[model samples]
Target: MQTGKIGVTTENIFPVIKKFLYSDHEIFLRELVSNAVDASQKLKTLAITGDFRGEQGDLAVRIKIDEKEGTLTISDNGIGMDAEEIDKYINQIAFSGVSDFMEKYQDKAEAIIGHFGLGFYSAFMVAKKVDIITKSYKEGAKAVKWSCDGSPEFTLEETEKESRGSDIVLHIDDDCKEFLQKSKIEELLNKYCKFMAVPVILGKKQEWKDGKMQDTDEDNVINSVAPLWSKSPSEIKDEDYKSFYRTLFPMNDEPLFWIHLNVDYPFNLTGILYFPRVKNNIELQRNKIQLYCNQVFVTDQVEGIVPEFLTLLHGVIDSPDIPLNVSRSYLQSDANVKKISSYITKKVADRLNGIFKDNRKDYEEKWEDLKLFVNYGMLSENDFYDRAKDFSLFTDVDGRHFTFEEYKTLIKDNQTDKDGQLVYLYATDKEEQFSYIEAAKAKGYSVLLTDGQLDVPAVSMLEQKFEKSRFVRVDSDTIDRIIAKDNAPELDLNETQRDILSEAFQSQVPKLDKSEFMVDVQAMGVDAQPVIITQNEYMRRMKEMSRYQQGMAFYGQMPDTYTLVLNSDHALVKKILSEGEASTKETLKPILSEIKGLQARQTILQQEQGKKKPEEITQEEKDDLSNTEQNLSKQREEKKQVIAGYAKDNGTIHQLIDLALLQNGMLKGASLNEFIKRSVNLIK
Candidate 1:
């Protein structure tokens, strides 16, 4: 036996390993099991090269947990380290045996996982002491045992091992006894080694015996030696892919489609990316794409590896080229990462395009589920946008779908405005915006259903991409004004009549929370609704963007502003205006006369002030102008209050306002109750 201090620059390395080696202490199992598998694979490589004349028996990596003894052992039947090799690989903390093997057999070696050689030290995180019993495959080689007790001091001695392999025994620490539990170890194996290249055996297979689960003699393998992503796409059946998907996520719905990624030219990447059915909640679908390094699970938070939008996809991505740190918990920034991202983006776009081209009817059938993913990709990645535009679809409220170019061709003749811009009309809620959609359809315009979570930003991005095109919500404005081909008809009412009508209706508008209304009297046809509520497109989009974007919370805090458009040609509005004028003309006559005199003085004072420099103007002149403006505002407000008073008692005005609110799904609670009662009374 030979005992000595571990060759190290500092004695504090063991403490660092115990406390800060890994973010999670559970990662120690993954590290140890991965090392065992690497040894097995290295033995296979040597066997293939005719370097070893040994029998390649069961290469399965087995794990055993002794709860009473408080020891968890991971054993492998493969090439093991002799005393000399252990001294070189184990004593030297950072020297990697896998790296040395790869340098010699780069083309022949099977998936070798170790790189930093720090994986062995991760055992100290949860183990008070660790023992390695190994026997080399070389002829006449001696078995060796290495013991370390969570310190730089370690012992190396001769040991008896019948097989040519290694056994890593972890004496779990008192605070880390969870590693000794069978269920806990099995969980770690499932998460970190589910798709490992080597078959991993956890324990005996269980059977229901005498109304309870009992361990049988059969070995229970926890990992698949060859996952679906590791196979050729041609060899995999559609049902097989779906079965694998169910194995990955048992609770999710059936995927719309999947893309088999197998590229070796630019960078080594292989995986299956499934396009899951993404509904309204985009956030719930993130972090599903698992990243693997040579089939060893690295992480599921593959944010920088794939495009941000592709995070919505669910599947596995295995690539040896992706750079990782010692822990392999986080991805490191590298040029290969960006290359992989671009390659994945291209593959996704290509798969979508292929599906669209091959079976457009089927693509349309799946569009409802695929819209969120495609829209997100187009909105977030410009390169993806360039490729996705051909396959991305625009679904109308009538359940009809069209590609961007196809929709452009279908509507270019009629939906083009006088400015030669193609107007794309869309609606968010089909039932709530039914009236607006009908109005747009009456004008022979198709209205798309832009109701996805990302549609707000996606529409904005499309506006920038489409040439001379704009996306307008069907309820954003009157159909005639939204895609105006001719000048609007003039209103018959004068300015005072229009102002009175606006004020009267505005007074009757419901006081909704976080909402403001601006009354606008338009000369819509007599058949049009008396009142229609529409939101400003830019402000509404900004508010919607605040839900998904950062640094835009100010828009979310602002009150929702809507335009209450009253058709001047409609009978109800005309009658209201006529009655308001008849009732308030007598009271507003004196006020109007006073306002006119104050306004004349105000205009004269403003013109005089504008001609003189700020220093030349007298303070008394400024006061006179200010006084005239205040008086004029006071008289106008008095006239409005008189009109508002008349409107306050008018149930017709209140009913019309409530009707518009109801159409937009904004009338709620007490206000909605009031509208119902008033509607019944008016009917009676």
Candidate 2:
């Protein structure tokens, strides 16, 4: 037997180890179990390499608990160290100064284990003392017993051990007696080693016997040893992938599709990425992708490890290249992490492109669910956009899907305006915009369904991407004006007639909160409605964009401005114009005569003033000119009031405005109720 001090420069090494080894003391179980698995795997590798001539029998790592003895043991049939090997690896902790180390690294406890070779010392987190009993597989090697009691000194002595393996016994401290429970140790094993490369046996399989659950003779292996992701893609079936997905995320719905990632050259990355049914809640499915190293689970918060957009996907991403012992902030800055992120983005894009090329119908069938993800990718990753250009599709209101190029070719002849800009018509709500959609369809033009939450920003992006292209909501203008390809129809009303009708229609329009409406006259065929309401493209887009973006909130807060287009060619509008003309003639004749006289006097006064300097004009002449202008304005307003008074009593004018309002989904609340009341009264 031999007892000696640990080879450390500072006597404060033990306190530092206890204080600065791990963040969550619960993580100690993972580190210790991981070490045991590594040792067991090393033994198997040695046997395969012919370094060990002995039998590599039953290499199951077992964890045992003894509550009464207040002890927890992790044993493994792997490379066991003799006394000299223990002194070299265990006694001498490199570059450790107890006092300074504690002060510098005390706050960064989780970073200490993988930084230095202190995997064995993590046992001290929950245990007051730790003992290791082992016999090496080497020929003629004697058994060794090593013991440490939370100090820089340890005892290494020759002892008897029949098995060629190592058993780590931790005497659970009073503060950490929870680990001495069998169920607690089993839970930790399931969490950290459920999919480890080697089998992990906890205890005998239990059965309900004699009114209690008792252990059977068979060993209860806790892990599957080989998870589904580690297998070749060719060997996996659809059901296999589905079953594995359920195992990974039991509460989530089945995924829409999956991508198997296996790459070797640049950096080793292997795992399965699942496209879950995001169902308009992209945020809910985020952080579902777990990161693993060598089949040991690392973390699911893989924001920096994966592309920002790819985090919306759900699954596992196992990469040994990702640094494990660093904080998330550090991992995000690592160059290797960025490479992994770019690679994952490339893989996801490739998979989507492949699906599109092989099965377009299937792809389109899944497009509604895929829209949010694709829009997110296009918004975030430029390279992803460059790759997705060919496969990305724009779906129209007729339920037809077209690529960007295909749609451009399809509509280049019909929807291009006289200004040489391609006009792309779109509708946000198919039901609400049904009339506008039909009007656009009547003109032999296509209307896209841009109703997704991201479509507001995406439409702006597409307009920039497509050359000489612009997006017009179907209700943005009259169908003729939406795609102004040929000659515009003429409105034959004289200036007097146009003003009278414009004011007549404008006076009766409904008043709505956050709403502004303008009156414009258009000459449409008699088949069209007498009145129609449409919004302006630029203003509507600005308002829509304001919902997702800041700095443009002023646009959102502004009133919705709609154009009340009165169809002059329609029979009802022609009748109203004739009535307005007759009713306003008597009121306007006197006003027009006075306005002409006032304009003539003002022109004469200006001529008189032009002949003299500022002081030359008499005060009486200036007063006469000002009085003439005021009387002329009063006569004009009276003429306008006369026309408005006629319109106020005209049921046809009010009904036409209400019909247009109802068609555009603008009639609501009190106005809608009043329209219904007037509609019922008119029928009676």
Candidate 3:
């Protein structure tokens, strides 16, 4: 036997390989199995190309563990290398200047495994000694045995082999003895080679003979030669896709639908993306998509390869074009990767559009399950928005669905406001906003159910996309005010009467954290509730967006603001004005008179001053104006006390406010309890 140093400039290659060659030493098994797969695939290619005339008999790759000998071997029946090929590919260290390479790359040793075509050397990461015994398929080729003992030096000589193939034998180091375990090697094989094109046999098949586990003579193949995604879409059925989905995500619920991606034009990309039934719990369902390179599993964290939203989809994406091992920065900047991303986006949109066009009823039935994903795609990908624009639908509270264009036509005439804005009404909680929805329907308007996580941003996007169109929450305002075709009927009460009633209602407004209420007198025709709480759609949407967005945290931190609109036509409010409890009215009348007199004086002073600046006005005039404003403010405070007195005794006012609060799902804690109690008392 003759041995020569591995032609390299550095002596510490073994230690560097052990410590940093791969982030997870467990990956050594993957490397070995992958090499075996590549060998088997090469043999198949050679046979197809008419280079190999010999009968390709049983091209299965086998992994054998010899615990007694303290060795593991991966053997494949493929085109084994000759001495010349071995010297060129294995002996010569391709990386120039080993010492500098090690020092510069030690920190990234794990990342460097695949960079220098060092897949074979990765065996040294776990083994102290490695041996390759092979007989090439070429004519007049002799069998050879090559051995290395954890150093640059190696020995190569003639050997005896039964068949034309290669055997990679690894004498596992004492520190990595865990690899000796059968379960460990099997796990690695499953991870990296489960869907490879060639059969990967692990051990003998097990049988439950005699009601006990026993090994059979048959070889136990651990991989599928042809995975689901490799087949034509026409040949596959829904159950096949479902079965494949189970293979990818065993614990997940069955997917709602799947998109089989088979594209070979711009770039070779093939995969199946399944839309799982994600129910409100978002974090649990994310990061399910598995990314593969040439059928070898690379990562399930495919955020770099796929759009941020599509990461929620579960499946296997295999492409030789996408590099197996690279930094996220590399994938992001790679030209082919960008093309692949665009292709994926187009494919997903096309699949969705196809589903919408082929079976709209089925699409509508699945809309509730699909809304979150569609909304996410629309918000995250502009291309997706452009494609989904025609097929994307608006589902109403009554369960009827309409495309964006269809909905526009359905509600254009009635929902269009005097400002020529086509108002798109939507509700978050159908049950909670039932009254608002019904009121909108009464006015010949349809209310959409915009309740998904991405609906807030999507609504904002839709408003921008549709010209002269605005999205209004069903309960954001009264039906008449949401899309006013013409001016609303004027409230009959004069200035003094309106002032007294306004102060009476405003005084009783609840002081909750971060909450502000504005009292509005609406002639809502007595049939409406006395108090209806309406939120500003823009502010509410901004607050909702703040929940998911990072920079908008300030909006989320702020308390929700609502408008406390008082319907002047309601009987309770009319009674509050007409009956006016004596003790409360006595206290309120004088304060009202004082405020009216102060306001009259202030108006007279303002008219006299006319457009003049404070400096231009006389000191007496300025003082008179300031005193009138102060007296008016004080009188309003006094008036508030009278309304508070009436509110304290009047269950109707408290009940109305509580009802509005309950409608908005905002009445909580002790206040909610009080509202419940008041509701019960008022019903009695």
> Candidate 3 on 1-684: residue-level lDDT in tens?
556888777988767765655666776776667666666666665666676788788887899999999999999987777776566657876532223333654543211113344567778888889999988888878888889998888998888887888999999999988889999888888887788777889889999999899999999899887889878999999898998888877888888888888987777788899988884567887768777666767667777678887777778887767754321112334778888888888888888899999999998888877877788888888888888888888988877889988888998987888999998999988988888888888767888997777777889988888899989998888888888867766789876556556666677667888888887777877777788888888788888878778999988887787888888888888887775545466676677777778888888889989988767999888888888898888887777676666656676777777778787777789888988887787689
Considering summed lDDT, which 10 consecutive residues are worst modelled in model 2? 107-116
Which portions of model 2 miss their true places by more than 4 Å?
A: 1-25, 66-72, 91-116, 120-162, 169-188, 206-214, 326-332, 591-640
lDDT of 1 at 44: 92
Candidate 1 global lDDT: 0.90
Q: Which residue pairs show backbone clashes in model 2?
A: none
Q: Which is better, 1 or 2, measured by TM-score?
A: 1
Clashes of each: 0, 0, 1
Candidate 2, residues 520-580: lDDT per residue as tens digits?
9988778877888889999988988888787999998888899999899999999999998
In order, candidate lDDTs are: 0.90, 0.82, 0.78
Give the per-residue lDDT digits (tens) of candidate 1, residues 200-301: 999899999999999999999999989999899999999999999999999999998899999998899999999998877788899899999999998899
User: How would you order the candidates by TM-score, starting with the best?
Assistant: 1, 3, 2
Strongest candidate by TM-score: 1
Q: Give the TM-score of candidate 3.
A: 0.89
TM-score to native of every candidate shown: 0.95, 0.85, 0.89
